[model samples]
Target: MRLRGRKGIRESLEKQEDLVVLQPSLWKGRWSEYFGNSNPIHVELGMGKGKFISELSILHPDINYIGIDMYDELLRKASGKVRFRREEDGIGLDNIALALMNIQGIEDVFAPGELERIYLNFSDPWPKNKHARRRLTHPGFVNKYLSLLNARGEIHFKTDSRNLFEFSLNSFADLKLRMRAISLDLHSDGLREDLVPTEYELKFVSQGMPIYRCEVVVGQQSLEAHEIRLKQEGRV
Candidate 1:
């Protein structure tokens, strides 16, 4: 969706040619060069309207963040938020960037061992069995994530759909991924104090819908095998 208000932010984003990567192939091996450092990188796929990523960037300025979304209309809104924060804070928030791209081409945008973490917030469930491949937790997408994630990289997922959560659990088990942290009802008062609530998570919780959350680690062996298979097939 097109962002409303903040015309100045829109203009600023228009001039920030280097901050937004429109080309997917160029992102494969140029992330460090683009960010000007080799600091840890984190990504949020399907960053809708920028609330979650923007807030996370503000919370953690030490690590670099990239918000990926294919819809230019929605990305423009996300861009406006990032630019506005940079202008208002005057803190040179250079750690954050936005990309107009799809998650299917994640490997094309990030080199091997590039990402430290990935966030999947409220992705479409694609509930039908025929559309299972489109689910973020599906084997196909998990393989794509394995291509760019570091050996111990973590994937954080939070969703309101029980079907998607169950499917993701099964997918991770089938893939033999080691899952450390798993929460079936994130809204419970017993939740860890360290948990950071995303925009969608907060809304869902307030509406009395229990959120599902989990963290999966990509082991060294799995990482190596994933890389070899991707290289052989030439896509992740």
Candidate 2:
């Protein structure tokens, strides 16, 4: 949930220097360098309030994590969550960074092949046919993601919206991306290990909503083919 136009919201975000970087261009291609490590980088593409990625960084300290969200309303809350964890634990996870950017402009901030993994969690469905191209799983965004990811890189996606899940599956297939894992009902499907519930994920699971998940691998060479298929489908 958005904090809804909190006064000085931008200033609040500015105070969170230990957790998020509001201006990320300086560390664009040198992201891993900011972390002082060569570990593989993974990004959560639409990290609303970021509960998932923060926990993920704690769990997989060996891997670097970046959380990108467009709203300061969301980032402000996420920063507080991380700061509270640090205050209580005496050791906040250091393997994480946050960026505020429109997903479409991500290409301007990161070099091609910079990410080893990307996660799209409960993205906006953009359910109407006219708005389909704006969906995060649309071929346009998928192609951009593929370009940013290193060869053999994988994207992990999760959603509670069945329509979006099905749509994303078709998007991945259209790109001929290989799927290594899929779960139509993740919480009850016997794939419980390593499942770190995001804030929204917890709410949905509490209400008995089924969560959909999949892992897709795309190669750099296959990108052109995906674009060709998009034009063929008139999705362009």
Candidate 3:
């Protein structure tokens, strides 16, 4: 998913001071010092080209944002966008940062109970029975998120694929996560005016695809059960 003719973007990212390089193996427990704030932290996994998070950072200056993607080239493009916005508009978007890392290593990048919110925007469906474990909604990744999320944290998700949406719904239910809100078609009838469009979300809407969205709330009971299971499995 690397973009061609991105030399200018690469140079822009290199010049950006806000884009943080998060090497999971090295910065396992040092994110708090990097941000220098006890304020709530929000993360977007598989941030793609970073349209959603970049806009979000501009909209929410109080909350710190961390965008994660595995592709170095994609992140470079995303970082370039953020840098351009800051340079042109003097947006002072210092609260946002980009990390080149995989979601599976999320625990290694942030301390336990550090993230206040998580966003999953149009992640790869990995639509095969044999690849179920690779899906972001799978229990393995859910457990990882549970460990990192605060007590009242929530995970927001949006996708245009019905199969992936259905699979994620079932995975949340199986994990005992309560769905606080859901919209089968985000752009129809009455939609929130404050809703911002992601890069893929906008494309999907233009193509006549319905975007499904939901928020899952983490409960104390579910957290306790997760902790017990983790202990029993020697995960702690």
Error of 2 at 225 (Å): 23
> What 10-residue stretch in candidate 3 is worst by lDDT?
1-10
Off by over 4 Å in 2: 1-3, 189-191, 219-236
- By TM-score, the better pick of 2 and 3 is 2
The residue pairs in collision within model 3 are: none
Off by over 4 Å in 1: 1-14, 190-193, 220-236
Best-to-worst TM-score order: 2, 3, 1
TM-score of each: 0.83, 0.87, 0.85
Candidate 2 lDDT over residue span 141-206, tens digit each: 998988889864778899999999999999999988877569899998543667877888888888
Superposing every Cα of model 1 onto the true structure, what RMSD results?
Answer: 7.6
Report model 1's TM-score to 2 decimal places. 0.83
lDDT assessment of candidate 3: 0.80
Question: Model 2 compared with the native: what TM-score?
Answer: 0.87
lDDT of 3 by residue, 107-147 (tens): 87888888888999998898898999998988899889988
Quantify all predictions' global Cα lDDT against the true fold.
Answer: 0.80, 0.83, 0.80
